[model samples]
Each structure stands twice: as C-alpha cells, then as structure tokens.
Target: MTGGRGRFITFEGGDGAGKTTQSRLLADHFAAQGRTVVHTREPGGTDFGVEVREIVLHSRSHIDPRAEALLYAADRAHHVATVVRPALERGDVVLQDRYFDSSVAYQGAGRVLDAGQIRDLSIWAVDGLLPDLTILLDLDPSAARARLDVARTRYDRLEAEAAEFHERVRAAFLDLAAAEPERFLVVDAALPVEEIARIVRERVDASA
Candidate 1:
C-alpha cells in the first residue's frame, strides 16, 4: 500500500483559473522527485464517470438543482471508489483538476442550497475522503470569464449565472480556505499564467 500511492493532491478553482496547468506542473515536479504521479480530472476520470459527465455538464436545458447535485455526488462516489482510492493505494500522487470543492461552490453557493446541507451531503457521498491539499486559484469572475470566452456545456450554465452568484461561490471558497488554513492554498491567479505557475511551483515544492 505504501510503495506506490503516495498522496492525493487536488486542484480546485473556477473556470479559466489555470488549475489544470498548475496541477500538471506540480505532478511533474512530484515525478521528478521519484514519485508515481497520476494526473486526472473529476466528472470524467473513468469510463462511467465520462458518461455521467456528459449528462451532468452537457444538458441542453436547465436541470433541477437537486438533481444536478445528486449527479455530481454520484459521479464523485464512482470516481473515488474506482479511480482515486485505487491510485492512492498504489502510492501514486493523484493530481485531480476538480473534486468535492466544486460541489460546495457550484451547488451549495451558486445553486442556493444551504451550505450546511451541502456539506453534510458531500461528506456522506465521499465517505470522509478529503484532499491532502486544495489549491484555490483565486481570480475575479469577470476577468476569468473574459479569458474563458464562453462556457460550452450545461456546466457552463453556471457560467452564464449572475455575477452575484459567482461572487457568492468565490466568497464561499475563500471561507472554506479560511476554515481550514492548513489544507487550503490561496493563490492570486490573476497574474500571467507563467508567473502564477512560478508561485505555484514555490508553494507546491514547499508543501511536498
């Protein structure tokens, strides 16, 4: 169990925040340090997850919030049991692009579900699995959106959401980091990608 799966590091942020780029850098760094690093993403990390992702992210019309939450939770449960846990047990450093944090921000904050309720449901869904670290690449909503052009999926439905809603999600994410200072990494992602990557490199190396 200890030979391959090392630790699980998750990268989380709003769209256009450059988490995927930074996560890969960190994964490569870990690999250079002689660890087995697996770079993956949520909602589509497995075959079933891939199928579910389309239903969740690509629905043509508005889907009920409660139903969307259930879909995300279900995808997460499958991802953990099939993809995440096995990688961890193999001692691979799992670098995930998005995870539970998305549910908390999107469904809890954006969807108007009571934060406490979402937290409880998420806890039950994942059965206590938590990231070793969550790097939140903080950026202004408008700036991020401009960089992103337009959202392409039903998940992007949230993309067209009111700025106030995204603001709430941002505040909630910040609050989450505040609540758990040790595990939440707040970075100013408004900087140029390379500069942001540099800061990420410094921070991740320190953490590693």
Candidate 2:
C-alpha cells in the first residue's frame, strides 16, 4: 500500500486494552527508523476534535445515540481532512489510536444502533480513507475493566458504562476484525506488554 505514499495504521479495541501504550511504542519504532510518523487519536486529533471528544466522552448530560454517532463522524471528518490526509500526502506514517471502527463498535453495537449505517457514515465522513493496517488488541471486557480500574481514578462516560455494554463493544470489535481479516491483526491483549509489542511489530514490518 505504500508505493511511495504513506501508510495509515490504526489501533482499535475496548477501553484499557493498551491502545495508547502500543501506539506509543509503534511510533517510537517508526521514529527510530527515521520515518515521519503522525501519532494521533480520533475524537481529539484536531482542535475541533478536542471539543467533540470532551462532549462525547466526558459530558454529564445525556446525548442521543444518533447524536453521539454524528459527533464521532464529525470529528473523524475534520481530523482526516486536516491531519490524516495531509500527512499521508507528505509521505508520513500515520498511527492513529482509534478510527471509525470504534464508532461502529461503541455507538452501533454498544448503543444498539445500526452498525452498517455507522460504517457508511464514517466512510463518507473520511472520504473512504481506510487504514492500510489495523491492530486490534482483543481482551475480555471484565479483564479490560480491571486494567482500567488500576490505571485511572476517573472514568469517561463510555468507560463508566455497564459491564454488559463493554462486553457488547468487545464482541463488536471482534466481529469487525473477522469481517476484514486482511486489514486486521488481532492479538490477545492479555499477553505481556513487550510480547504484544513484538507481535504488532512483526505484523507492521510485514505490512510495511
């Protein structure tokens, strides 16, 4: 997929699945190789996205499911337009923490909305800018929550959801990976951090 162009890679999983850790490690790997790496995350990659991230992830007031989905799509649209696209055009490797897959899993499945519709809206929002590779850190919902509990004293609105909701989100993530086997590298998130990073680097090396 490179062919003189930049590669876009994304990470997806339930909360506390170690996405931030893994993404930072991968970014370091690219930096060591002297590659121009854009390490960013959706819903907060751009200035506008920061506000959307606050509303969608932290707001105390209840937001409609459809509205939540739209907020994510809006963030994705602007982030891709201003940040992702330009970086790719400049031949920089883009490593994103989450993408539309999160929206499909969280809003579509967790909120009981239409997954396909959410995906379609995301595609339109980003003008079909799919990742060249997506790393999915698969982990059980309960285990993920346990990790989160130890890592943080506060939880976002999504993180504070019921265990059942997290379970649904995890299942949705696995389903998305299954449907796109070629684009996804599914790894057990229960493994040691170094082991997981090694596995991810292997796949990324092959893809690159």
Candidate 3:
C-alpha cells in the first residue's frame, strides 16, 4: 500500500523526550535527501488549533477528561485536513512532533480516561490513517521532569503529579509500542539529544 499520498511519521512519548528537537533533525535529514518535508505539532498547527491549545493546556478552567480527548481529536482532525493530508498529497514527508499517541498516553493513561473512548476517538479522528513509523523517545519520569523546560503545559502539570503517573504514562507508551511493534520503535531518550536524533535517522533510513 502507498498509504496516503506520502509518508507520515510521528514522534511520541512523555514530556521532555526531545521530540521537537529530534523532529527538527529528521526534517533536516529528509530535506537533505530532497523529500518535501512538513514539520508540525498538535493543538496549535492551525488557528483554531492554537485556540484549542490554550484552552486545553493553560486554562484554569477544568476540562473533562473525555472532552479533553475529543478536543485533541478535533485539533488533529483539523490539522490533518489543513496540514498533514495536503502535504502528503503533494508527496511531502509529514513529520509530527506529537500525534494521536500522545492522547493515548496523556489522556487515556494519565488523566484516567477510558481506554476504549480514547481508542474510538483515535479511530474516528485519524480516519484509518496511521503513521508509517512512530519513534518513541523513552525516559524515566524523574529524569524527564527534571529536564523539563519548566512548567508551562498541562502535561507538565503532571510533573508535579509525582513519579507514579509519569511512570504509568511511560508504561502506556511501551504498551502502545508492544501492541504495534512494526509501527513503533523505542529509543532511550535519557541519553544525549544527539544520540536520540541519530536513532531517529537510523529508523527512518531503515524504513525508507
């Protein structure tokens, strides 16, 4: 299967996993290889997504867990329509910093949302689309929180959530990898950022 019009690769894991940095390096690599590259993130790719990002991340007002998951799905659906799909149609490599799996870990595991609900929304929002490869940057909770750039986002709110929740999120990510081994690759993100980038490049090369 050619899948979509192009290749979709997502970077996933808990916060401070160096996803943004790794995505950038991989984009540069693909650009060097002459693959039209599209680098994007969730909850803020488009205008509406930016609004939703604020409401979901920084708002003092409480959002129900299911509602939060739905908002994320809504953001991703809009992002896919406006950003990801079009780029793929143009034969671009769509590299996402965080995609649907973030929802599965953060909302489904961290927020205690029902796993079935998350899975359903994922299926609906993604519309049968799945990443050709997902690079999971695995890190310990304390280590990740220790290196966090500082408390700004909601998941960062979980940094103070103690080590256990972050551990659960980590476990959830590993579980996701186990459930979809062919589509998922785990990397030890606790190492240097350069090493993580190298691992991502290797995975992409192997897949390509």
Candidate 4:
C-alpha cells in the first residue's frame, strides 16, 4: 500500500490513551521531513462533521443506540468524501485520530449492537476506504481514566460510560487488530510518549 501515491494512517484506542498526542507527533514528524501531511480527527474533521460530533458526543438528551451509530456514519461519510479522499488524491499523508473502527467499537460493542452490521454501515459510508496502517494504543480503562485531565463526571457521552462498556470496546479493538495483523501495529498505551512515537515512526518509515 505504501507503493501508492499517498499513505493513510489511523490511530485507535480508548479515550485518554494518548491517540491525539501520538497522531500529532506523527504528523509533525512527516511534515518535518518535507512530506505533505493532513492531520485530522473523526466526527469533527469538517464543518458538518463538527455538528454531528457535538450531537453524538455532547448531547444532553438521550439518543437511541441505532441513532448514535447512524450519526457517526453520517459524519464519516462527509469527512472521508470532503477531507480524507481529497488529501489522499493530492498525495498527502493523512494522519487520522479515529475512523470507522471507533464506531464499531463504541456503538457496536459498547452499545451491545451487532458489530458486523455496524462495520458494514461504516464501510459503505466510507466507500470501502481502509487505512494503510492502524496504530492501536492499547490501555486499560482504569489507567486511561487516570491519564485524563478532566474529571470523570465531566467526561463526554462515550467517555462517561461504565467500565464494563469500555472493556467491551477495548476487546473489540483488539479483535479487529488481530483479524488484520498486517494493517495494525498494537502498542502499550502506558509506554512513554516518546517511545511510543518512535515505534510508530519506525513502522511508518519501513512501510514508506
């Protein structure tokens, strides 16, 4: 896949697992090397996506599980069409903080819905676009909570879920990575930030 014009890299993990930090590190590294890199995140990558993200993540009222899943799909469809695909076509590396995997884990596993069906919905929404490399920062929900700057009571909708829900989400992420070892680089989220970034960079460099 690296032989292609542009590379697509995705970061996946539970909340407070340092996905944002590592993704930023990667984008900066590539940009420093004179590569054109587009650093973006799901659910809020575009204007419309931001509205959807707010509804899904910060809404005060209740939302049905299926409604939540569809909202995520809607955001992804627009984000990929307007932001991701265009960057890829221009041969720019796209460092994304999350993608379809989040929907599968959060709405499917965490929400106790059909994982396969949720995955299908996301695949169709994104038109089957897959990342060349997915870096899964695996972390225990307990430790992840400790790493968060915000109080637990102040967590977003998804982040405020029960521990058991987060466990299901973590398991789903591991299962997805296990099913696609060639496309996933699983790392311990407890590792030092610089060390984690180094490993990610090595994988990207080798693939490049």
Task: Output the TM-score of candidate 2.
Answer: 0.98
Candidate 2 structure quality by residue, lDDT tens digits, 30-87: 9999999999998899999999999999999999999999999999999999999999
Which candidate do you rate higher for lDDT, 2 or 3? 2
lDDT of each: 0.81, 0.94, 0.84, 0.92
User: How well is each residue in 1-208 modelled by candidate 1, as lDDT tens digits?
Assistant: 2213467778877887888889887877787889888898988988988887888777787789988888888888888888888888877888899888888888998898877777777778877788877889998888877777753433356667788988888888888889988888899988877787787678777876
Off by over 4 Å in 2: 2-4
Higher-TM-score candidate of 1 and 4: 4
User: What is the TM-score ranking, best to worst?
Assistant: 2, 4, 3, 1
Best by lDDT: 2
Which residue pairs show backbone clashes in model 3? none
Residue 101 error, candidate 3, Å:
1.0
Alpha-carbon deviation at 54 in model 4, angstroms: 0.7
Write the number of the candidate with greater lDDT, choosing between 2 and 4.
2
Q: Residue by residue across 169-205, what tens digits does model 3's lDDT show?
A: 8999999999999999999998887888888888889
Score candidate 4 by lDDT: 0.92
* Candidate 3: residue 65 lDDT (0-100): 81
